[model samples]
Target: MGRWDPDARGRLERAALELFAEQGFADTTVPQITERAGLTTRTFFRYFADKREVLFSGEEELRERFIEIIRTAPADLTPVQLIRHGLEAAAETIFQPLLEYLRTWRAIVGSDGALRERALRKQELTIEAVLTVLRERGTDEPAAEMIAKLSNLVLQTAVGRWVAQPVAERPLVAFVEEVFEQLRSTVAGEPVHR
Candidate 1:
């Protein structure tokens, strides 16, 4: 056990992201992160297993929250509607206040192969969590898998566009809803895209 600082973990994550963006992930180190965070290396380790974990933290919490949201959603929602509601819940919970972090994270994670792999693994885990929720709702087989994949795509596309596009006055959830609606329309044969 190490020192307990209420803000230590967030500070370490902020410091790590800043360092990773400035010096590149391959060149940044734990000491540098701790130093920048104004915390001891032991404090950093108390919060994160390693420097890489800094970039990948919160994933478990996010997954748990997302699954819980799905599980508690209204029982009458269609499978697609359930996924959409899950996306909306995620938007409210995970992606809303993370805009700046999303930008920095895109740069850092996109620039590093290892980080990208970790991100993909996180996606896989999220999909699995969604699948578990869908299965518990009595969804089965290819339908559940397909809905899970589609939901992931909607999430990825929304987040990607949200981060890659310019800063806008609109909320992130609005963008997610817009993208999801467009996807739904496209799938319905109305083709929002030309």
Candidate 2:
């Protein structure tokens, strides 16, 4: 590869995901990923701290996006509305375009215990960030905490359904909206529909 390869990070990520799927995450190495990507080991390290980082490289950015959504939301919106707005935005901007990649990534992460633990920790940190931002925006602590946790559940459920569908005809935002409706119905003591 040249010194200035285009999309080196993307190439590295695709290569790593392919390797992880074929050989298992534990058996894949930096050299193998670099080799598959036609990149140097130095290039791999420049993009990711380790193989695990490949799957989680966008976590901090995602968390920041959520915080920004909460911080800039209109004051009149309820906590649940704020979470729904943020999740829908995320689905449209982040998850929708990466549907196929995420399908593979989720499978690889689900197969490994360590990766699942790391994913949970990252999720907790994201929820904490959302809670802090909500409180800073004048929401009470209890409501902010509940909203933050509920946001995580909503996002996870939406992504799970979006990825698991046999035909992804609807966008991920649709799934987010569906989940929020289900949440609202359940809280209202109405029959929750699939």
Candidate 3:
């Protein structure tokens, strides 16, 4: 079978989630994932470069998906608004199915020291993705990077709440917009321009 089979990848993902929740990311090994997936080591290597990657391959897809999506966003959408759409698109593409894994994934990384460091590295790559998209749109490099990073923070916060919140009435994109408004109010009330 090819390395990129969605079913195979899903199996690996499920296996990794189980293992991570049980033993934590640091203790989880590729062989463990392969064994749990009932696949050979060769298969695991085919789908992911390493064990840590099972947690993160979605971020790579998120980068590509967000760039393609934000490019076509309506011109009248404010930058944050456009980014909210991009985040929601990426989330729907990547997260809705993985909600089952979210708790396990968080448990593995939540309090572990090494997993936290690795998660930060993954976040840096995500930020770079945002900057790349902003630059490609011909936004001033600094300002684009600034706005992209801000949007990233907004998305991060929004997603954290959306996933954790018991409230089911609002969509994630709507929550992102709500947080942005909250941030705007905070900014507008600041004592002085920094």
Candidate 4:
């Protein structure tokens, strides 16, 4: 079994998703999540602090996982390249189930303003965490943060579309690379000063 289990996290995650879907994230309670998970309220509290936290339950774990992967990545890789490599490794541990949760996450977030804000907050924190790792590896702050934010965007877009794609043929890493290429092309059209 992977260090992170789809089954165990899924239990809590799915419980939260259902309650948020049915009763709303704001309306749901911690007790209800425990009840749905067939676990204790203390257990629920052990894993999550409140109903809103369920959406972010895995964020820290996966962020640290990816950061470790990046820190240990080979020396010669470029920042974008290393991020890509780290993402591939992290995907094995991170992406698949997150895609599953995002479907429900998207629905709930779309319906509620507070949930949307929370989701944005989580994304910002994730980008900040990634940037911190990059800085530790000696990357400059602004560039590292920009790339991290862009990488995150690719992951979210890919995961959101992966299951919904007509062919379901593109790899997630490929999607990130594709996005980078598109952005590169967009920038290429700008007039050069030098």
Candidate 1, superposed: residue stretches over 4 Å from native: 1-3, 189-194
Ranking by TM-score: 2, 1, 3, 4
For candidate 2, list the clashing residue pairs, or say none. none
- For model 2, what is the C-alpha lDDT against the true structure? 0.89
Candidate 1 on 1-194: residue-level lDDT in tens?
25567888899999999999999999999999999988898888778898999988887987898889999999889888888888888888878888888889889999988889999999999999889888998887789999899889998888887777775567768877898888877878884444
Q: Write the per-residue lDDT of candidate 4 for residues 46-101, one digit (tens) a residue.
A: 66777777787776877777778887888778877876787667655666555556
- Candidate 4: list runs displaced more than 4 Å: 1-10, 163-169, 190-194
For 166-188, candidate 2 gives per-residue lDDT tens digits of 88898999999999988888899
Best by lDDT: 2
In Å, residue 102's CA in model 1 sits off its true spot by: 1.5
Clashing pairs in 4: none
Top candidate (TM-score): 2
lDDT by residue (17-67, candidate 3, tens digit) is 888887777778888888888788898887788887787777677567677
